[model samples]
Target chain A: MLDVFADYMTYQVFEITKGSKLGDAVNFFIYDSLKIFIMLAIIIFFVSIIRTYFPPERTKQLLSHKREFLGNILAALLGIVTPFCSCSAVPVFIGFVESGVPLGVTFSFLISSPMVNEVALVLLWGMFGWKIAMIYISTGVLVAIISGYIIGKFKLEHLVEEYVYQMKVGQNEIESMTVAARLQYAKDYTKEILRKVWLYVVIAISLGGFIHGYAPQDFLADYAGKDNLFAVPLAVLVGVPLYSNAAGVIPIVYALMEKGMSMGTVLAFMMSVTALSLPEMIILRNVLKPKLIAIFVSILVVAITLTGYMFNIVL
Target chain B: MMKIEILGMGCQKCSTLLETTKQAAEELGINAEFVKVENIKEIMKYGVMSTPALVVDGVVKVSGKVPNKEEIKALLNS
Candidate 1:
């Protein structure tokens, strides 16, 4: 029986390799690389445009002594206009406090920046069409706002430094430059991010391309197919360690779904890959206390897993 | 010239605040130097436990949060 299985595996490998030349593989890699670059470039471009035209500093004016709920809503909107990554979220987090922005409101901003971002949206659209992308973005923003409001309602503002409320930083640090200069700033910013994250993109896309080309459709169908309830959380778990995020992972999700993986599992995997990545966690440990960081991660796990289950049932 | 120090481990918010401060300073005609402080030992020197702390001139004015451009400007001017 083992010999039979081995023979079958050999045959499968041979079948996959047959008629597929090195040129074809190279072409596939190049095609996929362009797709990755285009999607990422669009996101980077959008982020730069927003940074140049409407800085997050402007949003500080909105949360000026507003009600917590309203402040959270505005914060989410601000996160939409200002595209910051998890790494840069801290300085602006400081800026919000020094500007008198409320704590609950700040949470909304934090959630929106990482959860519903340009990179995620464009990649989702590239892989799964605009409709799904729109749904994903809208839902993501909503989650940020609602979670912030909930946290605000609990009056967790005291968790912040007392000095934050009384303090002030000047407005001299606002946007100031000509169109050409701003453009340069944006371009340079995009290139910097690209340089940092291109490796992840390449890894994600290359793996996805190979899976697209040769993964066994029947096995994937039997295991991760639409009917398998276990696949959702399993996918989520498998995805968390990969750390590529929504932009890098969505293409793989799309390709896999096309080859018969369930949408719910794929989406859960995507969310896990983006929201609960190991690198994000490593980066997070610098600012957040272990308990608080653990809480944050737990919230994400519950929320994303639940989301996956719901999708499993509905879609 | 005003000197501003931003303390954080290079999170998105810290970087944005730094960018926003630079922009505000340019727009407001304030001459300044902006520096990012990522080392924990250095940040702790200012008694900052949380990240993205801000120091204007030599005094630690903002720690653990992003300050508005205006407020940063005011700190610089003051």
Candidate 2:
């Protein structure tokens, strides 16, 4: 139905020639925008409802006292449902720590929360197939787990700011909502996220359409193609400093992939952009010492770089 | 007299909650003392991990979201 509408708009309403590049790009833009918006709304709404069940307070209770490897895994999984923002990281970190949740486990939750979120998953599914989306999610969770476990093993407790340990966190009652309230919260949350991301989505899709219509075939293949040993690391390096939401970056990912960038390299780039952001690191610096922060970034960079290479070889 | 505390580290939602809560207080004609809790330690004392949280008379009424005016009014009345 959407395809038919896109075709009608492009050919009948706009009157660009049926097979012209402009018509093709316009058609691609319209179809993709409609499809992505629909997917984002439905997924975000359901995810928000799920989130209402897993606030950071409850997540802390779940993670506290669990052993390291298992805790890392659980934390990474919970990170997907837990409602966390970088701005609140300090309090969450302190809360988790004071409640006896291991540092590594806390790190796992932090890493996966931003990286393997519903928005990124939905966007990847919309653009790429489910197979690629699954690959992105699994690898993202693995990186979070492995990096957090390694940090945990290092026993970098002293590296945390002294105040984080000294501070006592009070326990408050978790809010309970009725079914109607949950539904309302979900509705409001979906609207809030869509309002925040729609502009980025439109801009990304437009840029992708332009690239699809105009960029030369195999333009990026020579430099960042599968054969390039350095391509994965290079993509991660570039992506880490360049901060953008998943919505803002997916169109560029589409453009790059269309230009023959390898799947692994592209996925790595997206993960770096979302997961290991500089601003998030800055926020974390409030509690983590400079050394701990450096170690955290380096571990993730290496892990992501490896994941990129593994994907390049496997798929 | 009621004391209402908005707990957050100065994020946009924190301010939004503050404004809505203030408006609700006026609408309900309740004499309330409003405190904006920006200190992380002070916020932690309330045991609220997420913000902006609404504290009515030292008890947490809500956290992690900006409730609407009607909801805030309900919280105030309660």
Candidate 3:
């Protein structure tokens, strides 16, 4: 279905330019935009439906009584399905902590929820193939678990606000949802995500289209190639300030890869953009002290940078 | 006469609870005073950290999740 649309778009664009470079760019833009938007809508709808089952209440229950390493693993995995709204992060953090979910376990969920979410998976799978998608999810979860475990070892419970401990919230009740309500929530969630991301997707894809048509393949490789040891960290630094969803970022990744950027550098950049963005830090700062937030960001940067270097070496 | 207070910072779930509570009250044919507590300080005064809490009169009946409409109806009736 999409292939036909892409071909037709390409034909239309090429007809005007008679196979010129501008035609190629326009063709690439149309094909990519159509393919990505369709995939994003379908995947986000289905994923939102699945998300209805894994709200913060349910996630708190799942991690409330589990042991450390096991809890971290479970939390990280659960984070993938659970829909995370940053506005609720504070309340959920308090809820989890009050319910006896170890602070570290909560961190794992917090980390993975945004980083290893279905949005990232759908975008990566659509553009980069299943292998990269699978790798990204696994590695993201692994980082979450490991970071949570390490934070657990540090006994940073003191870093959380003192009010959280004193806040005497009652035992939360998880209510069953009707099928209609679930579908409504799914539809709303899909619309919300699409609305927030559509403009970014268009811009990213257009930039990618331009790059694919005009830039020399060796341009980025000369500076950010695997041979450059600093490339991974630099990518992480550059990505942190750019607040974008996976759908928005994947176009850049696609363009970079086509221009000979290493898989490791690209993956590192993607993780940094999604996980360590400045906005996320500001949101989390409401519940966490500056010291703890610093530790969290440092750990994520280190983990992502290491992952990038390792992948570059191996692949 | 009954007072239904829904506590939260007015996120999506809180709005849903508000709607559900209104529907339940209407179906039960009860003239109830419904209040939405959106201020974080006000919510904290209830000793509830988790959002979308339902308070019946002065007592908190539910916290941290949206109760189904049937459950809300039951709470209203009780």
DockQ values for all predictions?
0.10, 0.76, 0.21
Q: Model 1, range A48-154, lDDT digits (tens) per residue?
A: 77766665656666676778887877777777657565655545666666666776787777767666777677667755678778777776676677777766666
User: Which numbered prediction scores highest in lDDT against the true structure?
Assistant: 2
Which candidate number has the best DockQ? Answer: 2
The lDDT ranking, best first, is 2, 3, 1
Please provide, for model 3 over A114-215, each residue's C-alpha lDDT reduced to its tens digit, 9 standing for 90 to 100: 788877886777667889999999999999999888888899999988877887765544668899988987877788788878887787777776665477
Top candidate on TM-score is 2
Q: Candidate 3 lDDT (Cα, whole model)?
A: 0.82
Q: True-contact fraction for model 3?
A: 0.20
Docking class of 1: incorrect
lDDT (tens digit, per residue) of candidate 2 on B1-78: 899999998888999999999999999999999999999889999898888889999898998889899988998997
The full ranking of all candidates by DockQ, starting with the best, is: 2, 3, 1
Residue lDDT tens for model 3, B1-78: 889899876578899999999999999898989999875545655656457789999788877667778988888777
In model 1, the runs with Cα more than 4 Å from the true position are A1-32, A161-172, A197-205, A212-214, A218-224, A234-245, A248-260, A277-295, B1-78
lDDT of 2 by residue, A86-196 (tens): 778888999999999999999999899888888888888988878998888888999999999999999999999999889978879876879998999899999988998
Among all windows of 10 consecutive residues in model 3 chain A, the one with the lowest summed lDDT is: A9-18
TM-score of each predicted structure versus truth: 0.66, 0.93, 0.79
